[model samples]
Target: DVKVTQSSRYLVKRTGEKVFLECVQDMDHENMFWYRQDPGLGLRLIYFSYDVKMKEKGDIPEGYSVSREKKERFSLILESASTNQTSMYLCASSFPLPGLAASSYNEQFFGPGTRLTVL
Candidate 1:
């Protein structure tokens, strides 16, 4: 079965601390994405990578960065943790469908998410 896993299910950090959120997929997907979910703002994309060593900034990438050093793993880095940065972080992976439109859709498999609390 296809599986996506995060390094932690819960994390706590102090202000100004550097945080690392790791994710791994066993499906050999071509794409990986990082998203942060907030109470009212909903899910916002932080970054995404289409291939190994290639990444693109998504909607909200200001305080966040991503690394996809290998095809099966993606990492989200928070340069300096802050209370405002606390949220649920999600990692997803997908591959383009052969018959579907490029911009239309791909079935993404998501991890359980890491709930981070910045103190």
Candidate 2:
């Protein structure tokens, strides 16, 4: 079975503090993504990596970054935390299927998510 796990289920940080959110997947997926969920804004992608040491900016990548030094581990970094950054951070991984449409290949498995609160 495939599983995704986050380093923490909940986190609290003060404004201007550096924050790191870690995620691990056991399924050996080729793609990993980081998203932030808010009340009304829905789920917004922060970053995604298709291969190790490769990353691409997502919709809301202003203050966020990601690292994928190993295939099974991905990390999201908040340079300096802020109150506006408080939200549920989710990590997802998916195996890429060859010869499949882009929309059909994204069968992502998600972690339990880490709820971050910045004061």
Candidate 2 global lDDT: 0.92
lDDT of 1 by residue, 1-119 (tens): 88999999999999999999999999999889999999899889999988899998999999998899999999999999989998999999998665425722977899999999999
Tell me the whole-model lDDT of each prediction, alpha carbons only: 0.92, 0.92
Q: What residue pairs are clashing in model 2?
A: none
Assess candidate 2 and give its TM-score to the true structure.
0.94
Alpha carbon lDDT of residue 103, candidate 2? Answer: 28
Error of 2 at 90 (Å): 0.4
Off by over 4 Å in 2: 99-104
| Per-residue lDDT of candidate 2, residues 1-119 (tens digit) | 88999999999999999999999999999789999999898889999888799898989999988889999999999999999999999999998766436723678999999999999
